[model samples]
Target chain A: MENKMGYNASFAEEVFRNVDSGDEIKMCMNCGVCAASCPLREHMDYPPRQIFSLIRAGKREEVLGSQSIMLCTSCYTCVVKCPRSIPVMDVMHGLAHYALKKGYTPRIEAARFGKEFWNQVYRRGRVDERDLAQRAYFAGGFWEGVKKILEFADVGIKLVLHRRMKLIPEKKIKGISTLRKMLDKAEMLDKGRSVQ
Target chain B: MADVQTTNQSILVVGGGMSGITSALEAAEAGYDVVLVEKNPYLGGRVAQLYQYFPKLCPPNCGLEINFRRMRQNSKIRFFTMAEVANISGSEGNYNVTIKLSPRYVNDKCTCCGKCSDACEAEIDNTFNFGMDKIKAAYLPHEFAFPMRYVIDPSIVETEDGKKCQEVCEYGAIELDMAESTFDLNVGAVVWAAGWNPYEAEKIDYYGFGEYPNVITNVMMERMASPNGPTQGKILRPSDGKEVKNIAFIQCAGSRDENHLPYCSGICCLASMKQATYVRERHPDCDISIFFIDIRALDRLEDFYTKVQEDEKIQFIKSKIANISEDEATGNLLLEGENTRTGEQLRMTFDMAVLATGMVPNKIDIAGAPEVAADEYGFVINDPEKAGIYGAGCVRRPTDVASSVADATSSAFKAIQSIARR
Candidate 1:
């Protein structure tokens, strides 16, 4: 009797009503192809297939709170192989966007990197790998940052050896003012549309 | 001439497999003259090659035996083995069919004697066993051959062993001079039961069906399990005849994806489940694992899935096998895929692996037989203009034995109805 809590449509309905392309998951057949094809599936609490299942089951807290939605690498393998062509990658990105919009902090490693990467890209035209890594490493407080920097030092040294990382910070791209204006305008439009 | 031909109310059922046999019997027993044509020198199509069928693990031969009996009892049914519909022309009620009969070389005059096969030294691949075994140059298709006749391979017609086979046969059943013949028949309707062929596993390439000896198909597994098959009912690896204790079944080998067959071949899931029985029955301690994206055991058939699942030995891994490579040292197959449930990247070894390859309509090879139109996958779709021609069983869509039988029976009624109108 306890297992008879059948799928609740309200959560899925609420998602469809609010979030963009959230209803695209209605095409999911739970074939597990998406999850199997996903390279980062091991790090996910719920694979793409199970995420859809949870969505159907009206496990709102579990679906939004899961770190799985934030783990998509956008490889498009699942999108290519899905029998139903569910646009699984898009749904994952959409879920992550909606989760952040709902003020639910994912606090996963990927989200941390993603936030740092986004902030750098928004401030400058592009990101400097050294500065981005520094910000990401130190975001966990001083001792943890020191440990993280030490852990990644080998790869950092390799990059420096290969000349992939410059000694100083990267300079701003040409037409920074124009780029900032466009970004601000796009952001204003995006926020206004989402609010509506 | 056309007016006289239009008066014939006979129906021709192509491909003497389950659908064709059922269609012929249903139409013939209902008092319409029926012609059952087969490409091979046998009546039972793919069903006869199977060790057992689904839902009920009954021997496929028993049902085929009874069908042949019913066919023998019915005088209205006239069947030709080693026959093909070379061409079909004219409209719904007045179709002129040209049939080409390939010489079996060995005539039906003699009894089922082993002398011809014994004397023949040349060997040929026995397709009935899915090339798992070899047959003598002169051989019966299988022990359960309906006509109980032998066929001489055309390749060895002028060879020394072929002459020796002809010389040794006491009854002069071997006819080396037998030339192929073509004949025509007038029929009111045609049942395109020209069934399906297994999607070639070599085309999948990654599974290495042709490259790796231990990698076989589900059909080959069925033949291996058959009591009269290559290994005589023993589940052994084709490479070295070692007992298969641990085996893997890869489902959806070429189906339900855009890369290969784009449609979900309905029977592969259940078919693989039944194939697992072959391994389990052979070795009680055999470890059976099936890698699949989804198990589509539908309706009441879920009972069989449940029964097999509850066996405690058969494990279902939720993943589509990504690739297969040979463990060159041991000659075992290494199956690689991520277990979606546990998120485990599996690189498992097995004594044997059976790919549940999908079914492709046989019409792909034999196209342009007038009035027969095919889908992209070569499944013959119903031609409304040529209303007399109806696609039965797998020709119309992917079907299981039960569905194919039901389709054959219903298609029989459709043919009869068309002829009655004529």
Candidate 2:
């Protein structure tokens, strides 16, 4: 396949600069151990190693559009086994957050999951599993919801057993406005708009 | 005769693994008398288990042969196999040590023939073989095993059957009547090179290491890839003995987590990649996927990673596997993980799964000597103030063979310097 290239020098600089953990990204040996160790690597459009390579090569559009970065579990196995101890998981998560800010359409499942989680946190100030599940099923669109409902019984039994099967939403806790403010900040960040 | 008196002193090298061998050789070559004690019946340590060393094609025998030869010729370097330093006392310039040597039953006179193995009725897991295969009660450790001698595992050898092997042997090499003995020696310094054990995978239940047949550790993969191994270097699934088509290597199975060992066991990444290359070479059609948080191929090793990636058969994935289950009938490994980029949780199947387990320091109970300080990760801390002891190889920290050797040499130099100054 021919390599598609795009450059985002400023964004790349921003990512490198904003990483909380002090690690040198340039030292990556690209052994693909991270990708290999990643539990979700098989489903990603581009593995962790390729994402780094693309980011380094200035392929911002390809990276943003790629479905791989959004699937990170943040399990930190790669961070731990990293011979150079690169903050790879965090970097990928940060990049995924960056992509979300742009107008890029998130893969259906993750986008709906994210929206449901946000709504739960926004409306109830905490996650109400039943509400979140219903919202998630509806927001993800029809066929997806039907497909999920087919498997929901198995999932619902476990959730019920764990006392997570709540029908009545809890009274809105004290943190809704604070959560809304955080969401607004996140939305702004997601849009590539500067956040003070 | 000279104004500056250089005292002739003996140094005790504990655990004849890589670091111990290096320390003993360096100190002995420096004209100091050395006593190397190994709990196992042979030297060469973990390196002997490996088929090949990375970056260099040198087999374990290539380096070990020279060291073994040096030990043979050097009278000053008195060594003991199946020996443990039971008690150690005194300070750096002068120290007393009591060593307990276990009975070998078969002595120096025994020729390494297949007779004893055939005669012996007892069978046990060969620790040297990484327990993938079995060995007779009377067996040699490995092909190019140091000392080039066979040992009897007294624990497994039945008293009645043991006599049968002794009677069958034409050569009077079998000495079932031998007894364990202890000896006291004076030494100037001590080098603790106990090495490391692979972090136990039992704790990481999510990986299904013990629960699933196809889920094996990286060390197991090493044995599987070795020509002298159980499968004779064939990468096949343990569940069905079918040739592995899709292999998934999970990096950092137990290391680099606050709940387990927090430090990276330096070589797991390179080891996994090397195994991937091994599989790619052996079975061109095999689909190899490595799931990891990052690709940590430092220095020129990055080139090797790139080369491996260029192979279409190998795929790299960036995600940490949170769960692994087995498909009961097929024994195919079901792995669940989140693809960070797409924010999607994914499920995949593999014929076999290899967990890149990290290293834990070898468990040794040293008595009478000052306690050796180790980090939370169980790696030895080398503070000269603490009993004047030094640690080398994996004991000091998790390192590759090159780094381990370098660390051993530096540790030897430091040990020699300490003795010389005194």
lDDT of 1 by residue, B129-194 (tens): 888878897988888888999889998998998899889999988899998888789898889888
* Model 2 misplaced stretches (Cα beyond 4 Å): A1-196, B1-8
> Of the true interface contacts, what fraction does each candidate have?
0.22, 0.00
Candidate 1: segments with Cα more than 4 A from true spot: A1-8, A14-21, A107-127, A135-151, A169-196, B1-7, B53-58, B70-75, B109-120, B158-180, B202-212, B249-273, B289-326, B331-349, B363-386, B400-403
Judging by lDDT against the true structure, name the best candidate: 1
lDDT of 2 by residue, B297-360 (tens): 9998898888878988888887777678899989998987656555455589999999999998
Question: Model 1 compared with the native: what TM-score?
Answer: 0.82
Model 1 steric clash total: 0
lDDT of 1 by residue, A70-136 (tens): 8888899888767676788988888888888887767555667888997887777899999999988
Going through the candidates in the order shown, the clash numbers are: 0, 37
